[model samples]
Target chain A: MALRRTCLAAAVLLALPAVPAAALPPGDAQRGQAIYERCQACHSLARNRSGPRHCGLLGREAASVAGFSYSRALRESGIVWTAASLDRFLANPFKAVPGTRMGYAGVKDPQERADLIAFLAAAGPCPE
Target chain B: MRDTITSLPRRSFLTAGARSTLSAGAVLLLAGCGGNKAAMAAAPEDDINILNAALGAEQEAIAAYQLGAESGLLTKPVLDLAVQFQGHHKEHAEVLAKTVRDLGGAAVEPLARYDFPSGDLKSEADVLRFAAGLEKGAVSAYLGAVPLFAERELAKAAASILGDEAMHWAVLRGALGENPVPVAFVS
Candidate 1:
């Protein structure tokens, strides 16, 4: 009887759906805009400051800006900006790109990182 | 030359001054008891070690600036700026040394010489770039150190120093005709 019950429980457990690993919280662009104040010190959506412009950061190739100088590490990275890649990069820029010149310590909080990414996604592409 | 490159910002100095004063007061308060009691209340071992590391870096910065100043690689206005930044590092070292002593730790002393890339520092631009790189590293180091302190006040003091270092980096970069503040965050 004990063996039968154990087998039944194992069968039930196998029927459950798998859960995703490290799922990020849903981002709010408005909240992200507020959090972006810290970023304003070096970045702007339309113009480059200390860092590259953010107007079309999402889906943009790393170090593709025409005139801005990029660190060799990033220029050679062959990165295409996406939510997932940006998430990792924004979490820790130094760890993500060893020699990238983005001097930011990175956004440590996941939700904040999500929101900032959302804001960038919503910021629209750079003007032609 | 841009004002940013020619002189330290007044507000940055004022903020550093106020924070240093507060930090000094906190150290004294921590050591208010007699010598034996104060000894018993020393900061955690890790904090002292970290502070000592920061002090060593500050000392190196002082030495590096002195070398640049004496090398005759910098122009008049740029040399003046380097001296001003060196003064800031001196103030930082003084505060760190005092805090270490107040916490019953022996402060780290400056070395007689530092191994800077002397061969590369042939021009004014080269020296400015080297100084800027050091300042940038200092900013990153302080950023990493700020969170590791056992005492919140110590963290705050480190952050204050970090801000000053960032400013120096920015000014040096500007002097080099590069963007003074390239990133929103110091890594």
Candidate 2:
């Protein structure tokens, strides 16, 4: 019980507002910029439009968006987005983080995913 | 909640009144001790009932995958994936059972035989479709329980499980010639 309590506390603290991080190969900012349009519906770099803001996604912990009422699952998931992790997650959001609430289906094409990841990675730190 | 399991086929293996006595003992212990009220509320009859129901559903899911694997309908890649999915269900089952125990509640035990209502497994498509249906059911069950857990932390656990169930549902749906990520939000 003590161990469980400590773990839960750690999870809660990690879920608090933090930075974002990701890893990806050098990508075509122009192509990635175009591909990123698909994610505009729910995600915006400036605000929590529909999903959490992607302003400073790189170097941040998963589900750490302050003031956003994230699904309990996403908040509790011990994940930090990186190129590799985000690649797997973006390929299948439900698979990467089963309880996450990012409603987008995911970019199936490898090139498309890479381009998008690159753009998001370089998008810079978010401030919502 | 043990009472609810009476109708479940797996309960037959246990001696009659065993669950009843177990529940009764747990209740007495809880009633006598000055336990945490919030915890007790978190494990209320309805919540435990939902947990048991989820447990039963997951148990059924594991069985379905096992049965599918044994049917010899899948090839190399398909067979490997089927086993991987089965492992997922097993993990879900373990977490669920541990949650039940943590809540000081009774859980459904694995039975010798589970009668999957979905009829005969004739072809590969039939097996995939059957497994898909079960995953869908899991999504439904866990999603429904997310709001029912009185304890906030338990709700988080339920939500986590619910997400995985939704993934399974979506992935399996895609395997059957359907768009994998068909929807954004799955209720």
* TM-scores of the candidates in the order shown: 0.52, 0.46
Give the DockQ (C-alpha) for candidate 1. Answer: 0.02
- Candidate 1 - chain A - TM: 0.81
Q: In DockQ terms, which candidate is top?
A: 1
lDDT minimum window of 10 residues, candidate 1 chain B: B32-41
Q: What lDDT tens digits, residue by residue, belong to model 2 across residues B1-187?
A: 3343233345543444433333333333333332335665643654555566567667767877889898888877777878887876676667667656755677777656654534578888888887776666456446545665554444555566667666776777777889877667653
**Residue A104 lDDT in model 1?**
53
- lDDT of candidate 1 at residue B165, scale 0 to 100: 87
Per-candidate interface DockQ score = 0.02, 0.02
Candidate 1 per-residue lDDT, tens place, A22-116, comes to 46578899999866755643355776543568998988988898767676657666568878778877776655765455545567888898898
lDDT tens string, model 2, A1-128?
A: 66664575465434332323343445675797766655542345665533567878877887898866565556666668777666767765544554344533456566677787778888888642
Interface RMSD of 1: 11.1
Model 1 lDDT per residue over B1-187, tens place: 1232225455665676744554554454345422223333443655665677678778888988999999988899999999999999998888888887776778877865555667879999999987877787677667766765666557767887888888898999999999887767655
